[model samples]
Target chain A: MPKKEVLLEINHLKAYFPVKRKSMKEEKKVVKAVDDISLEIYRGETLGIVGESGSGKSTFGRTILKLVEPTEGEILYKGQQIQHLKGSNLQKYRNQMQMIFQDPFASLNPRMRIGAIIEEPMALQLTLTKEQRKKRVKELLQKVGLAEDAMHKYLHEFSGGQRQRIGIARALAINPEFIIADEPVSALDVSVQSQVLNLLMDLQDEFQLTYLFISHDLSVVKHISDRVAVLYLGRIVEIGTKKELYANPLHPYTQALLSAIPVVNFDEPKQAIPLQGELPSPMNPPVGCVFHTRCPFVMGKCHQVRPTMQEMNEHQRVACFLYDK
Target chain B: MEPINTQQVLLEVSNLKIQFQLKNGKQAKVVDDVSFSIHKGETVALVGESGSGKSITSLAIMRLLPIPPGEITAGTIHFNGNNLLDYKNKEMSHIRGNDISMVFQEPMTSLDPVFTIGNQLMESIRRHRKVSKKEAREKAIHLLQEVGIANADKMIAEYPHQLSGGMRQRVMIAIAMANNPQLLIADEPTTALDVTVQAQILNLMMKMKKEHRSAILFITHDMSVVAETADRVMVMYAGQIVEEAPVRELFLNPQHPYTTALLKTMPSLDTDVERLPSIPGIVPPAYALPDGCRFAPRCQFAMEQCQTLQPEVLTVNEAHKVRCHLFSGKEERAYAEEGSLT
Candidate 1:
């Protein structure tokens, strides 16, 4: 293994939301959105967090940046655990970690001009004069491939790809070493998608940034990620390098997820081993392995016992009964 | 199931041109001189960007293009050997949804929130075909089952809001195929859908094409979907078919500059590039199009002659055809020589 410098280390991260009371005497039920997830993000490397909807991939990314308060976990940024910090300390930590939201339309304020929107992050984190901030915003916009003069235009005036570029520029306002891009290119067209992705790759090289890029697109993950983690029903089912995960995927869930992607070539035929059913309601997930209900190679032990993450090889980790000795 | 026959043309559309009347009363062509023939049960994809006139072309064929602002100025849209563009409102109504139906991009907003799937499905059958409530209800269930709904019986009672996005889309497909239409027009059917659901839907549509023998004109921007499903592909840009070829041939060897750029811009899943390339500028608006070739501004091999003279469609091979000056060897060699020097 090449010297993996840990940028962010998260251990036993859990986020639970309170469910409504059924009766007056009933205790509030806790929705285990993110049960227990342990992860390591390396310096200047893209760590892909991938999952279906309601898989807690988005929650895990947000909780790491302290956007949402965690019920339980120890998040070590650099070397220090930043779980209970508040006020100035929390603000300082936030400057180091920035997040790009999924929806460009909802993430940006519709009323604000493009320039002001990008400048808002810098104004909140840094103390700079108006002239300095404006100059910085212009530079940031140009870096993201937006025109300098288009600062006066509102978010609605810009296209989906252009808006996402603005969103990226805002995330880069404080020169944050780490970024959490939550499905940044999912909304754009395929032609425009490559542009945004290329820009992201370019920005990463220029800044030496670490990315916790969260998306459902495995192809995108495979293209950019140094390490890819597959999440299923609030659990990281598999974690390995991009080559290991795609070439020889261990977990049945990962296998199904990868096979589901439509092969672009018409010449090559793929025998799809589809997951039998839809992901069961997150409110009432199955016992033991959450994926066992849909896993093609389900074992008798899988239904009764939950599989823990076990290292199968030097860099590959899989949570599946089939992988167990 | 309708048997596949190569000679049988289910929908033969020729020289179809639609224009929108501007505030000055002058008409601006949106779909200019488009022609294609779709065989029974064959999937033909009309592909392009936001203003490529792909969607408008589909709407024109359906005779659903909004009037006043929009009009099918010239062209013959022949479906089942009938001139559909010349049909009166009542005459066109019989063809619309009875012989041909459409599925839109946004499935969620397209459906009525209050109506149950049962009512919507039955309404289409009852409205078009002279069928009683009981027979229509049974057909609706069968239609639901045909589109891959697990419990078609129970799902019919549930409202649109009650079902998942994929299920609702299946319901929409059920309605489109209610009267056993020979043709189906789908505009970005899988755009709002996730890849898994999208795969399921496309596979479902492909399966249905085999079973029903329905000719489908699918409008989409997804190159992957086009590569996977389309039998014949049309590359539209700025209200013209810049290139048209067999699906495999188009991707493998794209002749047009725009088509080549589009293929290059897409990040390959199987192959990785050091830096993903992009065409420098945004697609120019239709209102302010270049006088000669619409794609000249974005074309990498644009010459001085490209700005002055418009190129006619040139035959590359038996199956492939492209509208480009490069193929004709008409490119200004002196200008090209100068370009190489710079």
Candidate 2:
């Protein structure tokens, strides 16, 4: 096989938000939303980021998109460091990258018509005339399976599924190369969810789009992602090809997360390794191994020392002592 | 598990119709001709999408539906052989917390933020039982511990906001199980929690139910959860029960076109498919429902007869039932042929 092109890369990315202290005597604390994460996104493959709430999945996506300024580290887009880019340089990068939010109900502007909503991104980035932009908007609407006349209606006039299609159309307005969809279909019904997922996959092929699909749903992530990353408290615990990761997860966190998913099968008995307690607060994550507090296979070394990412196989990498040896 | 006594029926709802009066002087039939019965110690799942009337049906059984806009337009709800619909407000109030309890989806909103966990738990215990405050507090602590909350004593003093999402759900389960109600109505209880937390909560709920041998009206849209927790499954689409069968049977040989599409649509954990087979079009709004079958607009096998006439529930076997015109007559052969094609 030929070598796959790398579209984006990040090295030791960190995003920290300082918490408000109630008193002068209190020590200042920072919520380590995305802490020292490094990963590479291939040109047209979907890299899924799966984590529970507060696991910093959303923050990681935002930091990569430059929506949230990273506190530290480098972001390389197509072999060029774009993290520190400013003004027109940064604006140029934004045109090639777009985002589709989780909640369609809240993401789109209720006051604006569907056409205006889809065309807003183009108006900002593309140098197109009014007629040209209008034609493109209608074309994009039809591409997402929405009617051309749908542009005349407001956001409220559409159903949840239709609103999501509009969201997709808006994201595709500028023909982005990389799209970060944060739980795009989590809000839709099971029936409608498939429709959106199919449309996304179809669009990705047509546009040669690289997707950073972030969702808590393992089933969804498994369906669309070529490669998957498991995030635990702002850190990537495991990264591997979908088949390798799902079939043989090495990290304890990754294994627990995978087994916890309720399968729709009755022939096989459920083997959910129930983790004790909730995800710890990011403001004060555990020392050393962040997942040690709830890990089923915690060792003395795991409590005192953090494990760095180690390659387990050509397609799989894990950050756990179990695989380090 | 002890064998469920089929003779011991805990709750039976027959031809239950619920309507919401729209602002435009129109009434939308949110739940129409829905009928089912829950046997003692059995978990009957009510599965549906957002507007499929699953939640509304559960709320109606609890007698929690609002009055001005919402009303039980027709049918009857009988609990423990007594007609709950005929009971007065005050009389129904007695049965609310003691006989039948509910665990809502959003733990953060369902819990009172101002009140401490102990205060809330004891309030339910005290309301249903004749107990002293100190005794109620002890029982509350025990209930919390029963739901797998460590340091229950300390947890009781904490407010709802002080607890995490998973912890708050544990507290919610404790309150719901305080009285050991014969029938427990959990409406998407674990939907708000994380997958790990969801697994924990599901195990806890099953454990509690086993101890009490209570009937559960488990309501959720998640197919995996339905497969894991429910004993029997009822698939609802647009205010009607389209299919009913045992959990395994429902999953293996779903009869209704809607049920078949729903099962195929969900991305399964055990199997990998090239692309999910999705149903086209959206569920019709309740107010503007189609003339005949509710699912006809989206059903691929929708016959001309299905558009003009509504299909009644047909018994496929003793364990399975389906509501579709395809199973009516000669079309049954067509249904089987189409089924093999998929």
Candidate 3:
């Protein structure tokens, strides 16, 4: 077997946003949105990032894209450091990377026509003629399974599913090699969600595009991802190939999260390990292991010392005291 | 239909028709001829996507639909043998919190942002029971504790915005279960919540129902939640129930094309499939519904007759019913004869 090409590499990336002080006497604080995360994305594989809300999954994605400036660490695309790239250099990186937002209605401009919305990205990045851009827009519309007439209409006229298709069209406008879809199908209906997921998979094969799909829905992530990462309070708890991680999740948080999902299949016996309390405030996260407060099988060491990601096998890695030995 | 024990029935809605007035003086029938009954302490899930009229049906039951723009055109909503449609506004208000309470999807918007959590909980309690403010406040703290909020006393003083989404939803549930209403109507209550939090809330709701012996009208678009919580399920599409069955039977052998398609389309955690078998086309708009079966346009087994004639509900068994042309008496006979010939 040949070695797979690494499309992107992130190293100890940290993104923090300072919180406003309530009063003069109050101490300064910051939200540790993405804290010391490192990962690799293969050339043509979907890497799913799953976490609860406020777990900083979205922040991690944004930090990698440089949409939100990282406070520390490196973001390397195609083995080149691009985190500090600015202006035209960053603009050039934008052509190779694009993001699809969660809410289609909010992401697409309400005032602009559908054709213009798809063409806007290309116009900013590429030196294509207006006529060529318009032709490409039509082709993209057809590619996403939308009719040509959709290009003439506004955002509000289309259904949620159609609008999401339009969002995908716009993301592919500049022929980006990588796309970060942040909960792209969460807003869509069940039937339509499958359609979009299928389209994404088809497009990946067609263009050899790598995806960083971030979502709270575990089932969706499991369906489309080649590898999966479980995040807890802005830190990765577990990361491995989809089959290895899902079938034999080493992290306690991952086990709880996998069990928490209310599976539609009734034949399987359910043993849900209920996590105690809500996610602790990101502003003031828990001491030591971020998950120690809620982990069902937490040991004393889990409360005093933070666990680093350790390899369980060739493919699976977990950040937990249970796997430390 | 199976023999339904009238004594055990908590809420019965029959041939319910709801319409919304459009700007062009036309009325759009949002909910068309919907009917179902919930037994005491049994959860009946009304499952559908947006514009499928699941929310509208629940809202109509609460008598919460706006008067001018939205109105119930026909049908009777019988709560414990009482027709809620005929009740006066004052009488309906009395029944709302006292007997049938609703939990909305958006907990933040449903709760009063300006008021403290204790203030809102006590208001619901005081509205139904003739309790003093002091007693109500104590009960509010107790209710908060019951919903799994650890620091009830501290939480009571906090504003809605101060609480997390999960905490706010728990507070909402506490308020809903304040009066121990005989029936609880939850409209996608956990849709906005995270899966872990959703599991917690769902557990709380189930526990509350068991303790109070209240029937739940659980409405959501998620099939997994329905499989988890519902005792019986009703799959709605384009404002009509396309299938109704016991929870186990619905999952095991769904007869309706829509239900079958929905179950297949949903990405399952237990199994791996190359590509999901998705249903083609979008749900038809309510104002311009097709003449024949509503799902015909998207149905894989749709016949020529299905395009022109609507199909009535066909009972597959004592606990299962499906509304599809493939199950109609004529089509059944035709298929039976063809099978014999083959």
Candidate 4:
């Protein structure tokens, strides 16, 4: 919760993908996918990001890793700003930070053997010898619940769940203190999801790692995160400790999103405050509070102006006209 | 069948078995010993993961299974009193998309791109009912308006590609309801759309169900959709009905471990837990399924005997039935805490 203890601080992160016109002569249209969002990942803590498909949760994760370059923003990693840091400096930052992608099948190269996939990062970035990297790869395989013989197999040889484990092993190969896991379990089957989750948790404990876990699956995020940030159309609508946010959500968008999630309990019917309208295109986002159009509690001020995140009830921050008072 | 107030039994599919001719020259039984009935004005959600044979079961009812690879090996799909499987192509023309219509997962691909919405709508109406082209166009516009498509007549003139994904799905629903089918088979109707768009489709379906007196056979992998619309639920696993009960009863008191695990895997929007609870192991390949219990290898409560002997569907209560050794009391051994298959 303290800024001093923050391992990664993302300040005003912006990612805009250029839309190329039919003619090469025409100027490209910039789509502001991730628009000026700021958040911090603390030491040994999981900061959860929840949003619908195009809410820029993935873009936020990718932006931090420099997989997709941020148009603007300062990515401060351990007190030093990593954004715009190029060549050797960027390479160094990548070594300190690593990511586990959503689709493990696509992330892991099919032609590469599991051992090579895991060792590839170490080979390029680290000063470790061949024997050392191999030894490290074996250790990572064991850590993620894969057998030593699994190393010799190609990426396609394993199931969805197993391929995800290989991905975890590869992410850990760089020995990063900070990891960005982007919907790591979404592509997996329900049964296999828990195994990979448990493995990640175990690895976190052993390594004392901090995680920026971005997922639309809130329940999964709640199981592992210390704090959570709720995103709506490229902006943080609500953020607080898991208990505070879930127990008392302030933003209308957060409330609606939460209501959509179906709990297993059937004894009590959920008061679903269903959201209004569809998600606006990021290419042309609405003015004022991005969620104001859908918010049931919208006020005159909500339409006219954006609501800054106001601090409420010990560490909770919410952006909404209802909370403006 | 329960006592019908306004709800009538529209679609009654009994003892359905579908088989596909395998490349190995063997017949692979996909839909085996499946039976469920839907009321004329109720939503019966068929829920399962991939390869649970739900899609195939829906296809079999429509008599739409591809012949060479897929054949309705056995069973009867009785809509009203007529067995649909026995109906000739000419006879089925009266029912397919007229009496019983289907909505697939991807609406974009399913909808004819080259054909204008006007032609598609008019064709369906003319096939079943003897109506003038003008009357059919008017009916098509009316149907489109009912499904909440904006400026119906203008939109009908445009092709499916001209419409957004959400609007395209609305057209699919309009086509499905053009003749007011007694049974609607929606196989992952909202799966392809984003959450916001998915919500709209769901709302539209729920709205349409209210306006039209028809049974909805909603098939989806998402448990949330089931919780939203289903009056009753039929949970399938490995081509078997693991459990079947009233919607509320099934959720509150799930007798099967599979059902419980499924419930756990779904992350509640309200419960801000750190990690999602999940079951371990993937669905066994169809060819490699255990002779005794298909779910035995992945089941946490699996016992030594479960590997060799199939458990019968034993009634836990009047409202619940489960196919597991734990419920059957055939295997008394507790699930070892640390040795969970996951």
Kindly list the per-residue Cα lDDT of model 1 for residues A168-287, writing each as its tens digit.
999999999999999998877666787888899999999999999999888878877889999988889999988888889888888888777776777668778766656776777788
Give each model a TM-score.
Answer: 0.94, 0.98, 0.97, 0.90
Q: Is candidate 1 or candidate 3 better by DockQ?
A: 3
Q: Mark the regions of model 4 whose C-alpha exceeds 4 Å error after superposition.
A: A1-4, A21-29, A264-267, B1-9, B21-28, B116-119, B157-164, B194-197, B269-277, B316-319, B328-342
True contacts kept of each: 0.51, 0.89, 0.85, 0.46
The candidate, 2 or 4, that scores higher on TM-score is 2
* Candidate 3 lDDT, B1-342, residue by residue in tens: 344343598999999999899988877889999988999889999999899999999988899988879989899999999999999999999999779999999999999999999999999999989999999999999999999999898989999999899999999999999999989999999999998899999999999988877889999999999999999999999989999999999998777778988988999898999998898999998888989999999887789988999888889998898888888766766654554210
Model 4 agreement with the true structure over A9-100: per-residue lDDT tens digits: 88888899888789988876777889888887789988999998789999988988899988998989888988878999889888877899
Clashes of 4: 13
**Model 2: CAPRI class:** high
lDDT of 1 by residue, B1-342 (tens): 445785688888787778888886566778777777888778888889888899998888788788969977777988878888778999988888888999998878988989998999999899898988999999999998898888889988999888877888888888888877899999999887766678788888888766766888989987878988898898998898999999999988777878877877676567766777676666666666688888898777787767878778789898788887877764534434443211
Q: Number of clashes in every candidate structure?
A: 0, 0, 0, 13
- Kindly list the per-residue Cα lDDT of model 2 for residues B1-342, writing each as its tens digit: 667686698899999999999999888999999999999989999999999999999889989998869999899999989999999999998998888999999999999999999999999999989999999999999999899888989988999999898889889888988998999999999998899999999999999999877889999999999999999999999999999999999998888989888988999777898888999999888999999999998988888988989999999999799999989898998778766326
* Local distance difference test, candidate 2: 0.92
Q: Which ten residues in a row have the lowest lDDT in candidate 4 chain A?
A: A258-267
Residue range A1-325, candidate 3, lDDT tens digits = 3689999999999999999998979998999999999999998999999999999999999998789999999999999999999998998887898899999899889999999999999898668999999999999999999999889999999999999999999999999999999999999999999999999999999998999999999999999999999998899999999999999988999999999989875776698899888899899998899999898988999888989999899999999888666
Worst 10 residues of 3 chain A by lDDT: A263-272
List candidate 3 stretches off by more than 4 Å.
A265-268, B1-7, B333-342
Better of 1 and 2 by lDDT: 2
Per TM-score, the best of the predicted structures is 2
**Backbone clashes in model 3, listed as residue pairs:** none
Scored against the native two-chain complex, candidate 2 gets a DockQ of: 0.87
